[model samples]
Target: MSVYQGRFEGRCAIVTGGASGLGKAAAARIVAEGGKVVLWDLNADALAAAKAETGATDVVALDVSDQAAVAAAAKASEAALGKVDILICSAGITGATAPVHEYPLDSWKRVVDINLNGLFYCCREVVPLLLANGYGRIVNVASVAGKEGNPNASAYSATKAGVIGLTKSLGKELAEKGVIANALTPATFESPILAQLPKSQVDYMRSKIPMGRLGEISESAAMVCFMASEECSFTTASTFDTSGGRTTF
Candidate 1:
């Protein structure tokens, strides 16, 4: 039996960026544990593919940076899946790899919009539904860069750092309300997003990590699954690091 055996048997979960990478892995695990999943992604093709692959009926194409779109997506998810018992905010972008002063303003804004604002929109819209049901679990995907800022990636690092702060604040606010919120900081992972970075940047990232290798999607998914389960009831407003010894704090 799975750790989430009967925990989320009939429950519903929402996973942003679920079309691929960490989000898709989490959605797959949720379904394997007997939970229904509503996958939200900006990529329609990827969304369709993920739906077909996971056999998940609930899929939505919407930019998480758009607050109104996020609201609509959440409503649609509730209508499709009944109620959202778990939420995994994982949508993000690598942004431009350049010095802070040399970084393009547009690129920086876009990264922050997707990584930080997108998360805020999802949490803001989903929390109400959870509060109404009197139960909820949230796992926000952050990064090791958030804890220790990475050079040449100011936008990505800053936005992830903001996610950490937001998770902490929300966790505390809902601590007594039966809704738990937490953040996961994973080091460099072998994700599709990594392809966006240049080889030099990738090398720099790997060199800094003590693990000497990128993390696996399944490894990150396991941590997310645990956090979204009822077994993680007591912990809230905390950062769970899965950096393969790279995270020292």
Candidate 2:
């Protein structure tokens, strides 16, 4: 038997960026614990692969940055798995690394659109559903960079910081309504996103972690699963750090 042991039995969860990496890990764990999950991602092929890997039939190919698409995906998830009990906003991007003054406007916009704006759109659409059902857990995947801004990655850092702020605000707003919002900050997790980073950038990230190693995806997923579970009811609007001692704040 799993340690979670039906902790989320019969619950419905939607994991954005579920096509790969930490998102997929979370989805698999949720399903293993008896919760139904909808995997939402922009890559249809990756979504299909994740569905197979996790045995999740409810997969939606939609861009999280599009408000209409997020709303539609929310509706589709409800239809497929009933009301959402847990929402994990894991979709994000590691934008080009450049000094703030040299960063392209488009790159910054794209990062903000998907990382911060898209997360809000998902929350906006899902919170009501949770409120109607009288229960929900939302875990936004942020990063340590959001807390301690990283050099040459202003856009990524700023967007994640926005997510932290949004989570705090929403957590307070829904404190008495049975819906909780929280954010997770994982540092230098071993994932596909790291592959896109330049060698110098990657080394910088790795060196910043006091642990001298990158965090495991499963370690981060464990924190996410705990936050999403009914057992984590008392905490809200707080940021949980699983950054291998990289985050002292």
Candidate 2 regions off by >4 Å? none
lDDT of each: 0.92, 0.93
Q: What is the lDDT of residue 106 in candidate 2?
A: 93
lDDT by residue (tens digit), candidate 2, 114-173: 999999999999998899889999999999999999999999999999999999999999
Number of the top lDDT candidate: 2
Q: What TM-score does candidate 1 reach?
A: 0.97
